[model samples]
Target: MDDDALRAWSVSVRYPGQPEPALADVSLSIGPQALTVALGPSGCGKTTLLNVLAGFVPPSQGRVTLAGAPITGPGADRAVVFQHDALLPWLDVRDNVAFALELQGVGRRERHARAEALLAEVGLAHAARQPVWTLSGGMRQRVGIARALASPSRALLMDEPFGALDAFTREQMQTLLLEVWRHSGRRIFLITHDIEEALFLATELVLMSPGPGRIVERIEPGFSRRWLAGEPVRALKSDPAFIALREHLLDTLARHRQANDKETA
Candidate 1:
């Protein structure tokens, strides 16, 4: 892991002909070994901010940088995991995980070895030869995550990565992601609408509001460290403190929505 910090400086984005910016003056830092989650409702620029961080969409104003280098476009240094698993149907699990390495001209044996190790890390070693269509939704996401890790990326950027999974499966994936984060110690920036999930997974949580999306609040919830320190997931989530914080965040989001609606009206 490179431990390079990813940063956004007064970033803003506006689609052509759009009356307002999709993201306005959004600034944040994704430090090495920290899990930063962007939490917001639809059209709040969470995805837009993630895209800017991933270099998928260029900011109309301001800039994003990794270790002081400008993020002009997507690079292997920042791997992205989308809400949907975009695996190659024709390829088996191992090959799919190694696909990026192959593109980088890594030799077959080396890439395969690395892919197999990553599969084992994500608990998919047994499914190495299985085709993509054969895996369940959660299994497929594990493969996606394995693939992302196989990259030499300094940061992993995820956009609603668990949005497609059922509640139970999403929770399982969240636990698995935390384990991976603990083991890998790589920087992560994830966007999500799930309040509890954000609170549970984020070392730092950012709340955003729409109508030229801007951040409303930033919270540091230490639940992830507690989980890593051997606390059970269920217990952590059910803790009184956790419940109280969740309710507070929900109320905050509702208030923001009401204010935004009034301003637009």
Candidate 2:
């Protein structure tokens, strides 16, 4: 992975006729070694910020870049994994994972070989030949992640990728994701409303508030690093220090939410 960061500099977004900007002077840097999470309440512009970074939505002001080059539109350098799996129903798991490679004109044998390897890494090699529709929700997401890896992207931009899974599955996926990050060495930027998930997965967390959505706080939690260093996930999550920071983040979010509520009221 390139050491360059995916960056947003003073980015702001405004939809037509909307009195308030969706994001106001937002800035973020997703470094190569970071698992950055954007945590916020509803309407806090997390998704909008993601879109801008992904080149799906251009910022109304400021700029976004990777490796110092401006991002005018979506490129292969940044791959996105959405909340819901966007796999092709007609394709089996392996082909779905190879789809990105196929689009890039990779030969059949090569693409399949690469796809199979990724499937195995994600613990889905056995399901490679199965139809995507036959896979369970969590299984499908594993495939989604596998497909994202099929691209040559330097960073993965995920928007609530595990939100639809059950609690148990979500936790499992979180561990799986950490494993993937450790092995792939790819930067990850995720958006979520789940406090524990943010605390557990993020190397750096950006907390945002609504009413012209903007970042309220930035944190370096270090829990994901602890997990990478062979600490048990359960033990780390239950540690008093971890719990205390979790509570502090919760309080900060609540205070911001209350202020936003009063403003809108």
Candidate 3:
């Protein structure tokens, strides 16, 4: 799977009657083991770029490919976890995670075992028999993550998966997600408006700008690796290097916003 990479070349999206493209000349390559995060403000086409990558939205120009093949539409190769938990309300946590495996023709006993293991991985083992509606928001999102992982996909796509959670829950979820990523070693393309979240989770961070949304910067931060290497989360986050990079990103975002406002004015 060395050649298994998702690539977009000069991709642009234009909606009917829209004066500017939502995304313009955006090119990115997500390898088989990358945790890529796209960070930008609203209207910056972060979601647009993600949708295009997920094959939910087609680019008006250029093309997207996975392993050198053109992406025509959504496929089983990419599993998406939405901002809101997309769990089936009537299904129990175990069944919800096993649903995709069942659809793929896996036997009942095997699928159940796989689902149970995934639930445990996401800290939802105790909730396996619980009804979806009975789970808290964070629990529901854990179920969502488990479901996405149950797919035989090469890449996991997430759009603000923790955006709806409270601060404490969100941070907990981020830590859990990194643990999952470390274990799975699957490629990930995640979109988010949270700067700190992006910095914490991304192996490669892609910063985007509005006015026909395009990438402005690409950074590789070592915090995630440090966390994986037995560094405490709080200690790593409070490290001087981390704080400096965080402040720099904040300044860059401020400048982007000011430039956008002036353009509109």
Candidate 4:
């Protein structure tokens, strides 16, 4: 195991009174340069694994660590962005992003300046003074990303961050996220039920199964790095290799669902 990577070693999670574990013997490593994504159906424990990594939940077995340190509770080393933008409605864009810095006792001038730079990076500098509630879903999410960047987090952990947006807006956010990942250089660990989104954004994609959930497959699609290399998003997604892998993954998911149904029956 690489000491510098965020890792889950033989992790398992079983909720109280539950007959089956949410996750079983799952292991994964997220290195600095990889965009690690966990893709699965609703019961496949994607969020469970993410919560373990976030230190929001403890593993029933084994351990989760970041750069050799055990993750016992939530810490500043990881920032989470959720499906809905968890912005402070009262604080305008800039203030919301600066909120983290405020908690750390950053000076008024310094925090706002840092927040402004982050907003510009997300292409939202002009909206810094706008109320968060007045902004559209996608705009608010951009602010959320800016806020995450404001923290001194080493990794960005997102849970279905684009799931609430319309198709067009989701696509736009996907591109923006890739750009942010490139510039910020932070390790990304995102979970999603959207297959196409997973295929497009993951450098390392983990396919998970649901009966006492566990990893079924893992692959490095390399599409994200291609986008960073200046390839057009549409062209990359539509490539024959991309389409074939998408279909293969879809079939794998369907088979898992069938097996689970049979077990219940």
lDDT (C-alpha) at residue 75 in model 3: 92
lDDT of each: 0.92, 0.94, 0.91, 0.93
Deviation in Å, model 2, residue 205 alpha carbon: 0.3
Least well predicted 10-residue stretch by lDDT in candidate 1? 1-10
Tens-place lDDT per residue, model 1, 1-265, is 2336799999999999999999999989888978999999999998899899988899999999998889999999999999888999999999999998999899999999999999998889999999899999999999999999988988999999999899999999998999889887788999899999999999999999999899999999899999989999999999999999899899999998898889879
Estimate, for each residue in 1-265, the C-alpha lDDT of model 2 and write its tens digit: 3438899999999999999999999999888888999999999999999999999999999999897789999999889999887999999999999999999999999999999999999999899999988999999999999999999999999999999999999999999999999988899999999999999999999999988999999999999999989999999999998999899998998898788779889
Candidate 4 per-residue lDDT over residues 1-265, each given as its tens digit: 5668999999999999999999999999999877999999888899999999999999999999999889999989999998777899899999999999998899999999999999999999999999888898889889999999999999999999988899999999999999999999999999999999999999999999998999999999999989889999999989999999999999998998898899999
lDDT of 3 at 233: 85
**What are the root-mean-square deviations of the candidates from the true structure over C-alphas?**
1.8, 1.5, 1.3, 0.8
State the lDDT at 13 in candidate 2. Answer: 96
Q: Clash pairs of candidate 2?
A: none
The all-Cα superposition gives candidate 2 an RMSD in Å to the true structure of 1.5
Best by TM-score: 4
**lDDT of model 3, residue 86:** 82
Badly placed stretches (over 4 Å) of model 4 are none
Q: List the residue pairs that clash in candidate 1.
A: none
Error of 4 at 153 (Å): 0.4
